[model samples]
Every structure is written in C-alpha cells, then in structure tokens.
Target: MSTNTTDIFTIRAAPGTDIWRKPPTTNICNAPTAIPPSTRSTGPLTSFLSACASFSFPWRERYDQAGILLAFRRRSESSDSGIPPKWIKTGIEFYQSQPQLSTVATDTWSDWSVTPLLSSLPGAETEQWTTILVEKSEDEHGKSIWVYRVVVDEQTGEEKSRTALREICWVYGLDGEWDLEVVAMAARPEKEVKDGEEKELVVKVRGWEVKWEE
Candidate 1:
C-alpha cells in the first residue's frame, strides 16, 4: 500500500481572551538579548526565512494573528515539559479595532508590542497581504541578534515596501544554550457561536523558506 496520503492538516490554537500562551513578564517588553558565542559554533542557525498569505477574521475581533513564529527553549531544559522559554510571532493582528503589525515575544513570560503597518488603508474590511522576513545578524558589539522585517509585495512579486523591525537576541536561556524552531503560526482568540453555528476562523501562509548558516 502507498504510505502517502493526500490529506491536509492545520495547527490551531484554542480560542481565548488573547492569543498569548504565557503570563506577562512586565509592563514593558524586555529587549532581546544576544546568542551566546559557544552556541554559535554548534549553530542553531536560521536564515532566508519568509511567509506570505491573505486571511480573513471577524472584523475588529481583536483575537486573530497569522504569520511566522520562532520559538526557543533552553538547551538545559527538558524537552518533555513546559513551554519554550522565549518565542515571537509576527503578523497582522486586530488591536484597538485596527489591523496592525504585532510581534509578541515571551521569555519566562510573554509580552506583546505592535507597530502600525504602512499597508493599513482606511475603511477596509481586511488589510493587504504581507511577507515576513526573519534573519540573523550581529550588532556593533559583535553580539548575535535576530532581525524581523515586514514586507509588502506586488502581485508580480515585486517589492513595494520593506520595514525593518527591532532586533532581539537570538538566545533566551541564561543558564545555558537554546534549541530553536521556526514555524508558521495562526490563532483566533474569540469563539463565535451565532445560534449554534461554528465560526471557523482561518489564516493562510505561503512562500516560506529556511536556509541554514554555513
């Protein structure tokens, strides 16, 4: 029998008050830190990353996000238990009744921040499609950092706008090293039951790539 099956699977987060999977660390989101040099040799490296798609959510629901997410757990931690020590998800999210660029990072706990998108047009039911780029870089101090960028592209794959986002340390573990995983993530925070009709929320992601460092 052919082992291959022509089936599709989706990874979905449960609907909640918010999409955040952890508790708040503080009032202010902590700045990202640098990856330890020792870990660099073994290289939990990632690059040339991208994701693109269009999605629809209940207008102004304040509970939907779809894009690229990178999650890391300390190398010292057990692979069998608990959430990753740090993670970030970047994409279009509904907030304050407007769609904006949202990136939520968690270390020990979670913190969310938003940047207004240049693509957000007035009085639109949904915003335009987007591309997210994730890459690794070094600071003047020679520390390793992760850079996130939001790009707007034309239908022909021509560049329209590219906005460089804040860079954070590629590592989150203080005691030792970290194990990293990158994925396409989507979430819906609210459940809508309109007279027993299930409102199935969905998001799409495409054109993703991951190139390991040499």
Candidate 2:
C-alpha cells in the first residue's frame, strides 16, 4: 500500500502569531489572540483517518511552537458568521525555559496540555526531532480523536514507543458538512524583532504523512 507524505520544509512564524481562543470568564486583556498563519493541505473531513509528522525547532522564547494542526470548518457556514473553525494543534511548545510536548483543542474555547519530553533534560539543548500522530480512534464508550507522542529508533528508523497525550471526544460528528485542513504550523506569540532585525522562528518539518479512508 502506498502512503502520502510531504517533503521536508520550513515554516517561519513572526512575532505576535498564534492560534488560540480564550475561554469565557477568562480575561482576554494582555493575551495575544489571533489565528496564526499556516501552510495547509486540505481534504474532506469524512475521508480523513490519520496524520503524523516529525518536526523540530530551536526553543528560544515563550510559546514557540511547531506541529500538526487539524482544522474543521462546516461547508454551509459563511465567513460572515464571525466564527472560527474548530481546531486541534499538537507539537513542541517552549515554556518555562524548556521545551514541552503540547496539545490544544478548540471547540468553543481552547484547552491546553503540556508535558516534558521523555528524552529531554532540564537546561539541555532541545531534542533533534519530535514526532506526533493524530488519528480517529474508538473504544467501548464511543468514537474520538486521539493524539500521541511517538518515539522513533534512530538506527532502525522504526517506532520505538507511543504515549497517548489527549483524547478529543467532541470532534466525531458533523455528518458531511465539514472539511478538514491539515496544516504545518508554527507560532511565536511573544518574541518581537527589533527594527532592522530579521530573526524569525523557523520550524523544520522533516516528515509528514496523512491517511484517508479507502
């Protein structure tokens, strides 16, 4: 069976770029809220089964991130509604002077989770690469989308381990009115460049794969 994969590429995120929605009752003042620009490849949401990617970037500032984003938009909805599409982004995020594996899901508001990388040490340089997978999964309760942190063997180029990071239960329905946009996204919400400074956060996506329903 053949597989669909993307070539190695980079995504440059400027200052003030982010993809997030704050919850009600949470103060939006002093927070950066904007849809971060992304490089996208889209397909029918019903045809999407799974996606995985391996990526890395230098960790320098708070909220520096790069990873896979799954965005869903209803076909019949108009842009005039002023509603943002539901989305999930999973990847490496810099926080507390270290790099963490992070995931965010947004339906009405955004919820975030982060954990230290299993192979990393405090104050050590960031890992050479980090891999993640997002896929539709089911258990006895019902259907849902699952996110996983994947560990790969460097010598053999095979999967070494997989750890579940999050389970998103509300993304399973919509009939056929929704389409999916899979994106390679990066963001730096707090790092502003000075005048004449050309520095930017560039994330290197080494590998990307998406599987569709057959």
Candidate 3:
C-alpha cells in the first residue's frame, strides 16, 4: 500500500484521562482522556509516526503522557467502533515519579504493558526540542514488533553529543494488523475531570510521517 503523510497537526488535551492501562481499577483504553475533542479522527491504516515537540503536563501523575499514538483496529471490526482493540503510545511519560521515555501497548479489553525506553538514572525531561518515533518492524527473531525510540542532544563541558536516546520493542501478531492509524498527538489526565473542571495540556508537534500496509 502507498504511504500517506499529513502536515504538522497540533493536538491539545483539556485534562481528564490519558491513554493508559491501569487494569483492575481503571481501564480507559478505547477513549483516551485529556485528548482534544477536535483532533480525533477515524481514517486510514497508519503504522508509523515520528514527531518532534515540546510537551507539558498539568499534573505530575505517574501515567500522565503526551506522545504519538499508534492505534490499531482489527480487520473485521468497524472503524467507528469504540476504540481500536490494540494500540501503542510512546513518548515522555511520568514513571516512578521521574520523567522517562515510556511506551504503553494495549490488547484485548484494555490489557496494557509498560516498557521503559531509558535505563539510566534521572531520565530525560520536558525539553525545548525532543524527537520521538513509534514504528513497526521485525525483531531479530523475525517477529512483528513495535519499536519505541527517543533522541536528545546533550552537552558536557565544551563538547556537544548526539545521543541515540532510548529504545524498546514489543512483539505482536501481524495477522490482523491492517487497520492502523496514528494520533499525531494525545494526552491523558491524572483522573477524570468534573463537568466544570478544565485541565489543559498542550503539546507542540512538528514534522510527522504516517505509513501503513495496503
């Protein structure tokens, strides 16, 4: 299938739920909280998304996130049906009370898994410019996997260094992985907001690409 990419799109989250998987207690997978109501779209299959932006979260909650969402729907399912059964989001996440590159994937009834892209101490934070990518590829075992990566430039002393950043992968079946799409930007609030409550989270996204199989 041909690949289609869209121009830069800015996504705003008004505060509520964020795309996450905190089972047994809260499962708001299908509909992500804190996402701007105006930017949600039901479109073509999208498999890859690369975005650069400055992120900010209203409250420093553990699961709070603002990043690229790789939403996947089953071939036999309706595009308008609730939310995609399987999906993945990777970017800056507040984990263990620290800002770390985090990726979360969900499957079947909001079952989710968290993968920390960075292993060192004091993970990256909300900076001026950051690069994040979520792509589907085959692992060394030749299995279909989703790769999450981050890149940042750091300066030590008088020398500047380009870091590869952090990377992590997860395996998923490719049998029914056709209907895919990317949410250019998405956010989830710490908790559900009240009727009159306004939780605003803005993420500036620049340069993005979307690709999928026909």
Candidate 4:
C-alpha cells in the first residue's frame, strides 16, 4: 500500500515576510475562561495535564459582539470498528441547533471538529504530542490566510505522528473587526491516509516545509 508519512517533501514559506499570529489557546485541556478559584475544575491538575500530554492543543476566541468564547477542542469521544471515531467542538459562541461559530452579529456559523491520533495499543506507553505554529500572510484583497502546522508535544515540543491544517485569526479586518471573506481554502488534512497503514499522513504542503512522521 502507498503512503506519505514515510515520504518526505520540502515546504517553504511564501515570499513577502510578515508577522505571525500566535495560537489563541495553549493549554488545550484547560478551558480558556476566567474560572474563579471557587469554580475551577476540582479534578486533579495532573490528570488534565496528562490528557493534554497525549493530544494536541486547540483554538479559543470570543465573539466580538456577544463576548462568547469559542473553544475549539480536539479528541475522540467514541469510536466504532473501522471508523475514524467521533469528535466535537463546543463553546459559548457555537449554536447547538445551527452549529456555527458566533461571529460578532453573525448568529449562524460553521464549527470545526478536532480529531485524535494517539497510536492505539494495549498498555502502550503514554502517547506524546507535538505542536507547531504556521505564519500566514493575508492577501491584499483580504482573503483568509492559510494556517498549516504540525501537532507535537508540550514538553518536547515535538509534532504528532501525523500533521494537521489549522487557521486562526484575531479578526479579519481593521482593529479586530472581521471582514468575513469566503474563499477556496487550501485544506489542512488530518485524516489523510495516503498509504495503506491505518495511521497518520505526512505530506509536504508544496512550498511549505518537509513533512515528518513518528
């Protein structure tokens, strides 16, 4: 079976140097909210930290108008044989009925799901995570910037056995104001299975950087 994780490719940043947008949420396991000492999760911090140790972090931001935080989470809740498993994206700005991000005055918006890719095994040593940040340049026409990153661990800062596509913006317009432009986005794939292994996909994003696998 043909696969890409083992296939190496080179990726380089596009021309025109620019600044980078830091990821909104860092401590992925923890919710990005001002939880008072009294309202904080009573669970052991070690447990939360342990969970994050195996999975990649997520993105979190608040709606400008509603002041609701959109906490984008990744991890599988349940799985059926031969399936990739199911995940969810829950937060203040997401509507259960419409399931769209709450953008300023916009009520209906689309939500994203983060997938888990920890190597499944019996008593497999605790899996590791990798994290990375991709800097994207905005088009003069104000098109959505493309964000690409490699998932890695917190301690080692190593990427996951697989790579994923992520994009985040403070606001797409002037002074945190979102322009809301829709364009054909270059897909950052998570469930890519170029080869036959029931596992991760590692492929180069053209002119970006070399793809790595664990």
Candidate 5:
C-alpha cells in the first residue's frame, strides 16, 4: 500500500480557544477556525477509516494542547437538535508543567484521559514531535475507534512502536446519519491575551494522513 504525507504546517491558536462540551449547556467550538482548508478532510462517517498526524509545539502555560480532531455531525437537518457535534481529540497536552498524551471523547458529555510520556520512548526528551493515530476497528463484540500513540523513527519517519491509548465504541453508532471531519487542532484554554499582547500558541504539524473507504 502507498502512503501520503503533507508538508509541514503551523496552526496558531488564540488564548481561550478550545473545543469542548459539558453538561448543563457548556459548549465551546472555537479552535478550528484558524485551520486552513488544505489541512482539513471531510466525508461521510462510514467512508472514514483512519486519521494520523504528527504535532510539535512549545509547552507553555496551562491547558495548552495540539492534536488530531475527529468531529461528527448528523447529516439530516431535522435530526439535528441544535446541539454541538460529537468529537474526539488526541494529542500532546501541557499539564502539570509537562507534556502528556491526552485524549478527550465527547458524546453527550466530554471525558478525558492522559498518560505520561515515558523517558525510555524515542524523542521523549525534547518533547518535540508526537504522533497520534485514530482509526476504526472491530472486535467480536462490536465496532470501535482506537486511539494510538505512535513512535516514529527520526531519520526515516517509519513507525517504530505504537501504544494504545483509548477505545471509543459509541462513535460508530452515529455512522448511519453522520458525516465526519478530521483536522489538526490546537487550543489554549487558560491564556487569553490582553490588548496589544500579540501572544498565541503555535503548533507545528509535521504531517497528516487520512484513509477513506474504497
């Protein structure tokens, strides 16, 4: 099989920019507005197979994050209850003064998980680039989406190892009436710049790949 990779690009996320949903009417969807059209992929939910990307950014301040986002929205206008779309975002986030692999899945509400970056892993010291893959998978029980932290070779950009981070089963149930959009995303939830500050979080994306159904 052949593989495709995009050239390096940057995404600037303003302060207080985030993508989150919560109970009792808390929905924030202000992060992807900065993304360029060339970096986004959209299709029917059933047609989406997988999405992968490599991201790097300077870790500064609280609630800073950069990663791959998979968003799903209902296709029919009547089925839409005027609610926010379901989404999954996985990547490296700045927490506890360090970078950690984090994943957040949103259905009716948002749930988050985080894992430490082990020192033994490749490129863990510099905390430069982190690769994440979100793909469709199935087991005897049912269909699901798997989130993986992929370690790639610095020289050849080939996969060296991958660790499973999360498995979301609820997402596939919406395939019958939903469309999917995948893109690189960045957010800074706690740092809003004041007047004339000119400060923003810039995330460097090394590459992005999306697989679709044949």
Candidate 6:
C-alpha cells in the first residue's frame, strides 16, 4: 500500500490532564474504497475531519461491530405488583458478560466496533483502558460526523495504563504501534479521562486526526 503524508499527523503530551487539546498521531489503518486520496477538497476534508471528530464513525465497517453495556437492578422485590427481574448485567455478551454486576449500578466493559462501519476510538494516554464513542451521522453535507474513543488496561498486573511514561512502554509492547492510534482523538482538550480516583481533566494531545469522505 502507498503511504500518504497529507492525511497523517500526530500529537504528543507530557502527562496529567493536559493531553486533551493535543492533536492525535493518526495513521490510516486502511484507506477507503472508490475515493482516491489526491482528489478530495481540503475544505470538505476539514469539515469532514471536524465532523469525524464530532462523531466517532467507524474506520472499518466490517468486523467492527460490537457493543458492551451493563445494567443494574435493585434486589428488592415489589410489594403487590410483580415486575420481572432483569439480568443484573444485561448487555454485550463479551466483556460485560464475564463479570456479574448485581450490586453495581454501572457495568464495566471492553469491546470493539459493532459493525465494520464503526471503528475503535481510544482514550487519552492509553495502554488498555480506552474510552469508546460511536459515529452517528445522517450523511455528508447533512451536518453530523463520526469519531470514536476506546481505552484498555493491563488486566493481569492491573497497572494504570493512563500514564505517558507507561504508555510509551506500552507502545513498545505493541511492536512500534505508536500505540496511540486508537485513542488519539480523546487526548484533545475537548476530552478528558477518569483514572482510579483522580478527576478528569482537559488535555492538549493533538498532532493528527482521522477523517474520511464518500
């Protein structure tokens, strides 16, 4: 495959809450079909890019469809009326299915795109523990865009994967993945992340972003 520098860019950050605002270090996982890189206009491209940022549309529509949701219900039974009990954790079959969440109001989860039309969005400074968002839009020129945010964590060591230093190390583990590919968008000031107990903060993590047109 040929490489195109025009659409690729990257953002860098130090640590702690300032990574947002930073542009993402984007590398096209795969180019779209029918459209060549040389033909699209920049204005449309910028608008499209911003729209992509607005909505978390999937980069790959095929084999990218999946969602994990968790729900909680009170154990208390009804007095007179009978309401059927809902699963303590009724949601996606993968991650949410593994852990039973009866006591918790929110179900913890990990998943990728539900459709090839969807792509995986990553969180700010991630190693695992990424945040995810969906790309919801009607069509181009119609106002609406696509974007995504996903995170990951080291389930075994349970290490905090949000640290830049640790993230750098994590990238190496991915074999020069630049590792930031999944979560480049959220590193922006427009986004923030929740770590253990610390509050989320706006960040300046930009340099590259992903955008596509049809």
Distance (Å) between predicted and true CA of 209, model 2?
0.6
Q: What does the lDDT read for residue 183 in candidate 6?
A: 26
Q: In angstroms, give how far residue 144 of model 4 lies from its true place.
A: 3.0
Give every collision pair in model 2: none
Q: After TM-score superposition, what is the CA distance of residue 170 in candidate 6 from its true location, in Å?
A: 37
Worst 10 residues of 5 by lDDT: 118-127
lDDT of 2: 0.74
Candidate 4 local lDDT, 183-211, one digit each (tens): 00111122232354323211121111211
Question: What is the TM-score ranking, best to worst?
Answer: 5, 2, 1, 3, 4, 6
Cand. 3 Cα-lDDT: 0.50
lDDT of 5 at 43: 77
Model 6 lDDT tens row, 39-155: 222221112222111112111111111111111123233222221122111111112212111111111221122211122234222221222232224434453323333333324
Top of the candidates by lDDT: 5
Candidate 6, residue 45: the lDDT equals 16
lDDT of each: 0.50, 0.74, 0.50, 0.22, 0.79, 0.21
Off by over 4 Å in 5: 1-4, 77-83, 120-127, 192-198
lDDT of 4 at 109: 34
Off by over 4 Å in 2: 1-3, 24-39, 78-83, 121-127, 174-176, 191-198
What is the C-alpha lDDT profile of model 1 across 1-214, one tens digit per residue?
0011112223344444233555333322121211111111122523322233333333345545666566666556636334455667676777777777777766556667787765566763564556666555565765444545545444565556556665666342234655565555666666663455334445544444444544
Error of 1 at 35 (Å): 28
lDDT of 3 by residue, 71-94 (tens): 777666754657566676766666
Candidate 2 vs candidate 5, lDDT winner: 5
Error of 5 at 43 (Å): 1.0
- Considering summed lDDT, which 10 consecutive residues are worst modelled in model 2? 27-36
lDDT tens readout by residue for model 5, 83-189: 34688988988787668899999998899999886642343224477889999898899999999999899898899999999999998776458887788899988
